[model samples]
Target chain A: MARAKKPKLAVWKFASCDGCQLSLLDCEDELLAVAANVDIAHFPEATRAVIAGPYDLSLVEGSITTPDDAERIHKIRRRSKRLITIGACATAGGIQALRNFARIDDYINYVYARPEYIDTLAKSTPIHDHVWVDFELRGCPIDRFQLVEVINAFLNERRPNIPRYSQCVECKRSGAVCVMVSRGTLCLGPVTQAGCGNLCPPLGRGCYGCFGPMEAPNTMSLAGWFREKDTSADAVRDLFRTFNAGAAPFRKESEAHEQR
Target chain B: MKPAGSTDPLPAIIDKGGLQVLIDALIGGGFTVIAPRLTDGVIALDTITSVDHLPAGATDEQEAGYYRVHDGGGGRLFDYATTPQGWKRYLYPPEERLWQAKREGAGFAIVEERAPVPRYAFLGVRACDLRAIGILDAVFDHGRSAEPRYVARRDQALIIGVNCTRAGSTCFCTSMGTGPAVGTGADLVLTEFGDDAAPALLVEARSPAGRKVFARLGGRQAAAEDIEAADAAVAKAATMVTRHMATDAAAILKRNLEHREWAKVAQRCLGCANCTLVCPTCFCGSVEDTTDLTGATAARWRRWDSCFTSDFSYIHGGSIRRSGASRYRQWMTHKLSHWWQQFGSSGCVGCGRCITWCPVGIDITEQVRRIKDSEGGPH
Candidate 1:
């Protein structure tokens, strides 16, 4: 009888809160069950145990901020059969990418007491910028349930059933009254992806792009609405330039509004 | 029975005393009933026992930047315009224990706790709140693969919606095309007509499950007079609202992204995250793990987090939004502008919780208008 080979799984981190990687550990009950099916090859955050890769699945978290990290991702790409970027940092440049719009040296000096000891890059970039990623899980800290679905989909050799639509669909499905229409409140549900469920709005708040931009987000139209509502252009521009600041749509929008 | 129309039928009158019997009936039917009670001078949702716990004859006075209690209302128990709390708390808790873990021998052992699906009856849910729940259903249930936790709670839950008899000063659900009246998305919708008049509840069945529950309620079939009263109540509430936003506001917001009015609003804003927390649809969150003293056992938790926090946008060694201005801008734009691009609808539900709870009282409508009126170019 022939024995089935166990799939190798690896987890990597870059520039982020470690919340996204914790989503895996957050899968406490599911973790062991997942490990049972695959070989726990490399995960520095969860366990010290390390295994050489040629990994069947690689879950990379955070973004590349330094030259070393940029090069390291390329090496990871070569060794993994399928590379998946998890969280806002790995897919977009993350909130840290906000520095991409400003001077890096100034920011470094502002935070670090010993700026000389810090070796950094001009910009923080997503994994896709450095290497190919088979799948990208959106969210600041990716939804664990959704994360599990992605893993299961990959394991089953099928496309993940992640929604590419905006948060508005979720708002509609939730049957929430449009805050902008009823309260004249600004909200991001229409442009944000539907991963966090309809959390902010139900709480009487608007959606923030922690999950990053949705597919082909129509930011211009939404911004126009904000303008009529009295939201300033600088305010709209600044909104797109946060967390997922380096994302294409948000980045382009912010650049269009750049003062200098 | 008369055909169901856009109005409530049967002038469904429920005495203030009957509330306990209704609640008891729901509980006896193996349903967990959640209702609003006075908490910190504000109406908040909590599990209830009887009619005594309901805020009877109480009404709230809501303003553009304030919310307060007002005296002298009918004998009706649920007379408030809207509450700060929504239905998401029971369905999607702020902090949930995803699972627990421990080290076993040389290897580690993990245990997954599948959330117990409870049969819930959400009582006193407002029209806007019902709409919010429907939006959540799309995200949690409509997809090809359902979210196990969300699906479990939603599938077994029953909704009892309440129509707005009075509008809040900040309410603009009419502009959003969501509320003032309960249009759809409810197992039953109740509207309080007036003090002189009996409390009328218009019950409509949206699903087979709802129909079953409706049949069990044993209420008399609604008549035209009952529905007429209900219609009058909704119309009165719609007219009571003082705030309004343009329908084409989303498109205008998109075009004005480069407008210069943001700096002024940013000046007064503090990125404290109160707005996100009070929001009905804001879903951004973070995860944490707590280990025993021995570090041998650990339990991971997922908690509510806000983007307004410095740590929320942290990257590499620092944060992306180093200034309050940028963070505030990010939050508003995502909520109103980019939301349409990503989700095909606006993110906000117009509950007005953020404005009332903002501590500093930042009115979103005013902020948007200022930006729109500003002459300076994009930042």
Candidate 2:
């Protein structure tokens, strides 16, 4: 006749725009059910309430930018039973990871009024690059339903059903005409992962690789074709250097097309 | 009413106006009429009420990884070869809920999805697509463990075949022995001709249901010359298709599964799975189970899957088809060779959607020819 204690769920932010965290709050209808199921222990964005660890599940957002934040994540990892990296930031070092390509001190001197006050790392890296990540839910801003699915899977002790296939599969499944083939628009749907619900292509815009490179993505083949056709080598390079620019395959691809 | 397998009715000549009468009859008979119309800059199948909804005076140019719509120069309905999206989506949807479970007390109550299936009259069904449907029938309807949803939807469907007067550059239906002129499966078949002069259609009923719809048209019998003109139009379409698939591809592909050409193709292949997704008869699907946050309800969904995905061949350790070469080999070999062993026929209907829709433009016919050309070479 006793109710069991609920699993503690924590949402952590490091170097993100807080958009990924907003996805959870945006689950307005499912929030009630989610609240009932899990203990919202330490979500500073949603509630000032802070419950002590070790937390049952921690949903980490944003990349590890500062050295202090890097050390803080390892502590968070130690305190959490299951650590999931949500959004392109935590999984592949967000758009800010574009800074990873250049000198950090030069960027600091160029942008900051007080360069001496700013404390950061040489490279903006993903959480998994610093510590172990149980699972990664990819997107510029992660799909809320997929985030829910990942949490639900953790609760149910099952593998999450997030797809690792190209966005073209979703386009075909939804019967969306291929923007690239039909209109000669340059699209990254062939190499980008399929968690965005086939977003940009249907609107006559090409996929921007928001969900990062798909599993074993043939980036070279796609880039080669794009460069051979209307797209310039620089354009093709910049195509892979967006939201998930720090992802390994994309990083290698963009570097391949470097003007040097 | 005539029996279901009644003999074929004679072909009748119907003007452009008579085509509208047939559309009305189908709509009146409580069927959702899906026809080819221009949408999103390409010919697509969608619901229509009148014949004007069809893509008249319009045609498309399709090549490997390219498609463009242009003025066909003549006021003829059914001028296009085939849309990238096929009739498969109607019979076998991209995704469907299989069942749902809701917790009551200690146990949950399982509810099987029994949603009412719609009776569809698919207008502008190309010959190759018709054959693709036949292949799907074997996969879903004819099997012992028949898919209930597919069987119900297919049973309540009416096929309105359209003979191709012009072929896309990617099309090779003649090599596949499937198109240019329709054979067998349709309830009614239409051939468009005399676009510059009269703009007439030759309608033939191949089934009893089609005969009933044909009788409703009350059109004049097709003259010998009208039939000749219609035949000539389809014959020209056959000549337009320059691509060819080796007739002994089934044997040749099976023999050369480990050919060096597989690796060569992998270099150009993005492994995007667009080829399989757009393919008419690929027919691979996977199921996903999900539960709500409350844990009170759970549902299972079936969605189209492709071998190009790493997880498609996942077992305990890792995927069987780990390399792009292996996955591409599995798809092509299954379509051209293993399909015959499993279903007594090739899986590909030569619709050429794979060629047109592929981002990298990897042509299946060309790949087959390359493998066949260097058959029994170094593995």
Top model by lDDT, which number?
2
**In order, what DockQ does each candidate have?**
0.02, 0.67
- Top DockQ prediction, candidate number: 2
Candidate 1 on B257-325: residue-level lDDT in tens?
655566655555544455776667676666666543233566777666666655677679987876666
Taking chain B only, the TM-score of every model is: 0.90, 0.96
**Candidate 2's fnat?**
0.82
**DockQ, model 2, C-alpha based:** 0.67
**Among these predicted structures, which one has the highest TM-score?**
2
Writing each residue's lDDT as its tens digit, candidate 2 over A1-260 gives 11277899999999999999999998888777678789999999999999999999999999999989989999999999999999999999999999988999999999999999999999889999999999999998999889888888887777889999999999999889999999989899999999987779889999999999999789999999898896888899899999999999999999999998
Quote the lDDT for B229 in model 1.
76
Stretches off by above 4 angstroms in model 2 are: A1-3, B1-7, B376-379
Candidate 1, B151: how far from true, in Å?
2.1
What does the lDDT read for residue B71 in candidate 2?
82
